[model samples]
Target: MSNETNAILNQVIVLLNRSLAAYLADAVPWMGRAGAEVGESLTAMVKDQQQSADRLAEFVLDNGGDVAAGEFPMSFTALHDLSIEFCLKKLLQTQQEAVQYLQQAVAALERAPLAKALVEETLGSARGHLETLNELLAAVH
Candidate 1:
């Protein structure tokens, strides 16, 4: 791959990692752990999402792309500090950010044949996260 392509992929990895950390931090203390069975399920969902993020990071690194280590979008912090109930809203916001990031990442990958497969694989999970978050939010609202 060209140097430009590699650099962009590295940036995308970093962005994904940042999004993952923010969302995971926001969703701590699952609803179940807070004495609500529903919270437990949410907690499980968070864990799964975390795993997916890890996998994406790993994939990026495997391709010689470093995960982006940076601050989440400014909007994530306050909600990250809130309780699980309030945090569910933050999770929805996070998924929205992930979708946006993934879209850009995929667009970048479109030029790098070597990096395309990894980004495509990650795209599937990112899209799934968006769908799941939307469904959960619908139920909550």
Candidate 2:
């Protein structure tokens, strides 16, 4: 894999990790048993995101590059005051954005077939997350 491709994979990994961390931190306190199912679903999604990041990091190492972490500043104040419906909407939007990032990473990694495939798989997972969030959001109203 080329350095460019490695960098793209690393970028995607960092973004995934950052998003996962933010969601975990912000969503947990609000997720009592009433939100237990969704909380469990989010936990599973976090695990998947971590696994994806690990795979991307391994790819970067195998390709002779250091993985650079990506940072996203989280402002939970606005979200803190929101209702469950609003919070779910925000989460759904974030998942959609993650899917878009993974899609772009897949396109950029065309030369690295394995990397591309891994990213595509992660993209599918992100889409599934989006679907779940949509269903949850619909039930809110």
Candidate 3:
């Protein structure tokens, strides 16, 4: 892989990891209480996001790039005590940021076709999750 692609992948991995940490630290604990419809959707999103991150990591390894373990920022843990709606809103913002980040990555990777394709898939997933979160937030309100 090119240096540019590798660098973007690193950012994406970190972002995904942080999102996962936020979910596990804050969202998962309250998913059940979030409401029947929203809870079910959140559960599916959490699982899908995990699979997406794993696929990206495996892609990095298959391309001979080292896959670093992902870790969240320390302050994310401080958000654990917020309301379920607040947690979901925060996750939604994170997902939106990831989608935008991936968009730029895909654009930058145009010359690296394989990397671009992988990033596009992740972007699509992020968009889907973002839409779901919007609906969930509506339900919450």
Ranking by TM-score: 3, 2, 1
Kindly list the per-residue Cα lDDT of model 3 for residues 16-132, writing each as its tens digit.
Answer: 766843355443545445567766776787677778778888888888888766677666775666666877777788778888898998999889898788789989988998998
lDDT of 2 by residue, 1-141 (tens): 787887788778887788733555555546443476666666777887888889878878987889888766566455655456567777887788888888888888878898899889889988988898888777656
- Give stretches of model 3 more than 4 Å off: 20-22, 25-33
Superposed on all Cα atoms, the candidates' RMSDs to the truth, in angstroms, are 3.8, 2.2, 2.2
lDDT of 1 by residue, 1-141 (tens): 456666766665555556633455454534434435435545555565556557656766676665656566666645544556566666666667766776787787786765677666666776776776666556655
Off by over 4 Å in 2: 20-22, 25-29, 76-81
**What residue pairs are clashing in model 3?**
none
Residue 43 lDDT in candidate 3: 71
Better of 1 and 2 by TM-score: 2
The residue-level lDDT of candidate 1 at 92 comes to: 67
Please give me the total number of clashing residue pairs in predicted model 2.
0
Residue pairs whose backbone atoms clash in candidate 1 = 13-68, 14-67, 14-68, 31-39, 32-39, 32-40
Q: Quote the lDDT for 90 in model 3.
A: 79
Per-candidate TM equals: 0.65, 0.85, 0.86
Pick the winner on TM-score between candidates 2 and 3.
3
Two-way TM-score contest, 1 vs 3, winner: 3
